[model samples]
Structure formats: C-alpha cells, structure tokens
Target: MKKIWEFIATGFYSGKLPKMPGTWGSIVAAIFLYFFWPENIVYQLLIVAVTFVSSVVSSQSLSEQLDDKDPDSVVIDEIIGMEIAMLGIKATLPVVVAALVIFRIIDIMKPPPIKLFEKLPGGFGITVDDMFAGLYSNILLRLLIWRHYV
Candidate 1:
C-alpha cells in the first residue's frame, strides 16, 4: 500500500529523476500518450482527465514531501498540462512537436494569468498554473490549425 502510494505520487518514478525530472516525465508522458492514443479524441480526453486528477494529487503529496511551495519533482502538473495541450489534435509528429515547443515556451514564460495562478495555495496553485499554461497552448494550437489546416 505504501509503495503503491509512492508510485502514484511520483508518477511511476518519473519524479525521481536526478535532474529536471518533471520535464523529462512530461516529455515521456507526452510521447507515451501520443503513441497510445494517436488522434483518438476519446482517448485524448481520457488522458487529459487522468493526468489532471493524478497531477493534482501527486503534486500535493510531493509538496508535502518536499515541504515547499512547488518542488521540481512535482512534475505531474507538467504531464497533465502537456496532455491537455495535446488534446483534440492529430498525433502527428509535426503537431506533437509544435505542441511541445509552444507549451514549453508558454509554461516557461508564465505570462499574465498563468503567473497569477501560481500564487494560489498549495497544490492547487502548483497544478492550476500549469493547467492554464496548457490551456493557453491548446488555444494557440487551435488557432493555428484553424488558420492553416481548417
């Protein structure tokens, strides 16, 4: 039970990486999700939902473990955010690449409301901020698709 809890909290050991584990975990999760779903809207939505819930719970546990506002190891937030960014998109290589780049940029920049969201309390703060970043990336991707693909 304890081990299971740890696995769940750490995103199956992705959070334990020595450096930038969260980023690595997110990238890995994105890749896994891309292959696993491959343009299936239902699967994509399921992934987004699962990631969102798991991230919130895991991030909260990680915060308690680290005794900090938002530890880098708490990267389930990034995983969830990236998954949301990829939602509703064809899992093509180009689309995936674009989403990754755009999401990374927006997440790192922490613009406006995204930055503001980070100020919220506890895990909610940690997860919501990244969720907003994901939302921003999703909107931008939609706009791009509409402008060119639609």
Candidate 2:
C-alpha cells in the first residue's frame, strides 16, 4: 500500500517534522547509527546496500504517489545517506556527531555531481544525490581519521 511506501520513504515519519524534515530524518539516522551500526565492515557495507535498495524503491513509489519529483516529506534518502556516511566507521560519540554534521552539510550544499545526480529519473534522482553526499562525507571522515584530525 502507499502507506507502507510512505512509511519507509519518510523514515518512519521523522520526515513529517514541520521544519527541516531532512535534518530531522538525518537525526533519526544518527540515532540508528549510534545504536545499530554493525561492527564488521562487511556487514556495514551490506546494511548500506540494503538501505540503498529500499530507499530507491520506497522513494520512487512515494514520489509517484504524491506526484512530486522529490517530496520534502520523503526522507528515506537522508537516512540511507547517513548510513552510508557512517559505514565502516567506529560508532563513537565523536564520530557519530561528526558524521551527522558532515553528511548534512554535504547534502545541503550539493556540490558538483551531488546536485547533478538529482537529474536522474524516479527514486534514483531522489536518493542518489544524498548517497553521493554521504560518500563525500565518508571520504572526508576517513581522511580526517587517517590524519588524526578528529
């Protein structure tokens, strides 16, 4: 049913927040990462992969149902993006905080190819730009860890 798709796409209604729903959804994602992130890198990758697939399906369905390209009320993309950003990283307090900040900034800024990804059709358009932002956040986080900057 559409409710199911809406549930998934809205990150279980976190996206229904009156303001900055994406940020609220990302916050929910950060909480999920803090409590549930896998210890094994392989499993972490699997989680991201699954989240990506689910987000794509749900987002596309929700968009069509709502007749919008990228509905503000659909933020499974943010959840999946934060998941990707936190992938393979230790879920320490500092790391979680930094990941949230970085992912949000990159997502909001939408630099270069991140914005371009929005041009894709359906949920691919809805979800991938956030994934790219997460990728950028992941790379930056890894670099900071490598450099002992964080």
The CA lDDT of each predicted structure is 0.76, 0.91
Point out where model 1 deviates above 4 Å: 1-6, 38-40, 147-150
Candidate 2 error regions (>4 Å): none
TM-score of each: 0.84, 0.96
Q: Candidate 2's residue-wise lDDT over 76-132, tens digit each?
A: 999989988888899887888889999999999998978999999999889999999
RMSD to the true structure for each prediction, in A, is 2.4, 1.0
Model 1 residue 37 distance off true place after TM-score fit, in angstroms:
2.4
lDDT of 1 by residue, 1-150 (tens): 445544765667787888867667677766866677557788678777777777677677767777888877667787777888878777666676677778888988999979998888877788898888889988998887778742
Error of 1 at 22 (Å): 3.7
Q: Residue 137 of model 2: what lDDT?
A: 95
lDDT score at residue 70, model 2, on the 0-100 scale: 94
